[model samples]
Target: MTVIEIDGLSKNYGADKAVDGVCLRVEQGEIFGIAGPNGAGKTTVVECASGLRRRDGGNLRVLGLDPQNDRRRLLQRIGVQLQEASLPGAIKVGEALRMYASFYDKPADWRELMDEWGLTDKRRAGFASLSGGWKQRLFIALALVGNPEVVFLDELTTGLDPSARRTTWGLIRNMRERGVTIVMVTHFMDEAAALCDRIAIIDRGRVAAEGSPRELIAKGRADSLEDAFLVLTGGETA
Candidate 1:
């Protein structure tokens, strides 16, 4: 089943195009990735799909529902963790989780989520006091708190240390195991290569290549995903 479908999707910032004629599809229960260098329109595409931004031209569907026309219903079924997410400095970890969980009609237990995400020990810790990795974990927990069928994670592990990044990879795999579909926007080549079942490489507001990591490497005649990305995007891959 296709959970997301986009065709000729385009977005612009005045005269400059951020996303241009992009076409992509995401199937059910797979971790799909959108990889590119900064300013490559990777974020713009997902933002449009998530209904955070409007597209200039094209058709987009999330679970067969129009994102712009059916935003209210779509928001209820999808969870989003933006690239730069934040919370009130004084809010405790548990408090933040509880507050977000309350917004959903059928939310997961916030207490259990804290424990699952290794935030139980820091439940009372203020949001501002948490480290980058901890903050990332909390954001992920909050995104999943609503038990959404589809989850969008943008630059999810950007600031995490190596250990935390790998831990998050495991968590994402767990989410997929439980039948959730994932769409991630990331610049980390190794991260996307390791986690994404398939990926679309966007560059300069267009899709430069689309395939599995191995396929992309072969197409670019490179030994690794990073090198392949660099080759395809003319050294523009992040």
Candidate 2:
């Protein structure tokens, strides 16, 4: 089943086209990746699908309903972890989890999630005192608190150490096993290659390519996903 459908979607900021004629579909339980260089309109396309940004053209549907028109209902069924999320300077980890749980009609057990994310030791720590990896883990826990059907993660592992990145990858795979669909946006080609069932590569406000990591690399006659992406986008040293 298709959980998301975007057809000829376009978004513009004044004279600049952020997303242009982009089309893609995500299956019900797949880990879908959107990859591109900076300013490739990846974020804009995600925002449009998540109903955070309205498109200037084309159509978008999440679970068979218009994301813009059915935003309230859609939001209840989906979770989002934006690139730049912030919390109160003094908010404790436990308190932050509780606050997020209160927003959903049926939230997962905060303690369980804390343990799953290895956050029990820092439950009483202030949000400001947490390290980058801890903060990312907290965000992941918060995104899953609602037991959402679809989750959107933008640049999920940007500033993490290798160990933390691998740990987060395991958590993401576990989420898929529990039947949650994921839409991830990242600049890291290896992350997409390792996690995504299918990937859409965007360039200059358009989809430059779409396929499994292996398929894309095969098409480019390249040995790696990053090389394929560079070839397609005409990047230097690609």
Candidate 3:
């Protein structure tokens, strides 16, 4: 099912056009990827779709409801982890998760969420005291606490080490198995190729190209998605 639909979606910041006439359709129960070079307005597109930012023009819908008009209703069914999402330094892991759970009408058991994400041991740890990987684990657990149908993960593993990144990838795969639809944004083409069911390459506030990993490579006549990204985006590196 098409859980998200955007048509000619546009958002501007000052005189700069952050997103311009961008259109996309995201199916349910799939990991959709939004990828691009820095400053390509990838995050802005998601913010508008998730109802965190108001668009200057065009329209968008999530789960058949307008993001702008049905934001309050939608919040109960969707979760969002922004690229720069963070909590107060002094907050404890358990405290953060519990607090997030309280916002929803029907929430998951936060304690089980902690154990499921391997965060039980870190429950007492302060946000500033945890490692990078631990913090990310907490973030994902918090996102899922609302028992959402859709979750947006922006730059999910930007700074993790190889092992931690792989571990996080496993967690994402597990989410898919449990029937959660995901929208992921990433700079790493390899990660997108590995995890995404479909990907859209955004550039200059618009979609440059979109398809499955192999289809995209075939379309660009490149050996890899990274190479295909460079080819499809006119030499812009992702």
Candidate 4:
């Protein structure tokens, strides 16, 4: 069940090559990670695959459909949670969920989602007042409102404290357990190792190496995934 397929994918910004001849395959019900240092084009890869951005060269398919050609049809079947997930400061939790649900032809009940994500009590709370952790919970809730088969989570736990990060990881695992395919983009090697079934390390706009965390460590002959990433990327920031 290969849900996503890419071969020689490329994207560019002006004269700069943001993604260069990248290839990947993501299967059903797996947590696939795209990890890389800053400016390595990790986000661009997902954006292109998920139909957020158009590619300059090569081919990609998401859920057996061409992302660019079938964007409208694709959007209905996939959910995306971006790193900069944000809403108006005055928007309440319930309001936000309701708004997102309206975007889908067939959506999950936002109220049920609120309760399931522990935001029922905060339904009246304003977006500006919610803590970082609570905001993330809401973001995940919003992503699920469409009841999508595949979800793209980009840098999902980037700024959270340890506790919040762990909680977010639990939420991600819960998504996987429910048989949803996940494509995660992050720079944290430990997070990738902890949650991802397989990872592709992007460096300088190309896939430098890709495998399970342990397999990558074995390939680099390093002590850990982080060390292997550092070795693979020539000490670039993880």
Weakest 10 consecutive residues of candidate 2 by summed lDDT: 229-238
What lDDT score goes with residue 202 in model 1? Answer: 93
**Model 3 CA lDDT for position 177:** 88
User: Candidate 4 on 1-238: residue-level lDDT in tens?
Assistant: 9999999999999999999999999999999999888999988888898898999999999999999999999999999987776899999999999999999999999999898888999999999999987898889889899998899988878767798788778988988999999999988888999999999999999999999999999988898999998898898544
Candidate 4: Cα lDDT at 59: 92
In model 1, which range of ten residues has the least summed lDDT?
Answer: 229-238
lDDT of 2 by residue, 1-238 (tens): 9999999999999999999999999999999999998999998988889888888999999988788999888888888888888898799999998889888888889889988989999999999999887898899899899889999999999988999899999999999999999999988889999999999999989999999999999866789998998888888652
* Model 1, runs deviating above 4 Å: 236-238
TM-score of each: 0.96, 0.96, 0.96, 0.94
Clashing pairs in 3: none
How big is the positional error of residue 210 in model 4, measured in Å on the Cα after superposition?
0.5
C-alpha-based local distance difference test score of model 2: 0.91
The clash count of every prediction, one per candidate, is 0, 0, 0, 0
lDDT of each: 0.91, 0.91, 0.91, 0.91
Q: Give the TM-score of candidate 2.
A: 0.96
For all predictions, the C-alpha RMSD in Å is: 1.6, 1.1, 1.5, 1.8
Cα lDDT tens digits for candidate 3, 84-118? 88789999999999999999999999999999888
Once superposed on the true structure, which residue ranges of model 4 sit more than 4 Å away at CA?
Answer: 236-238
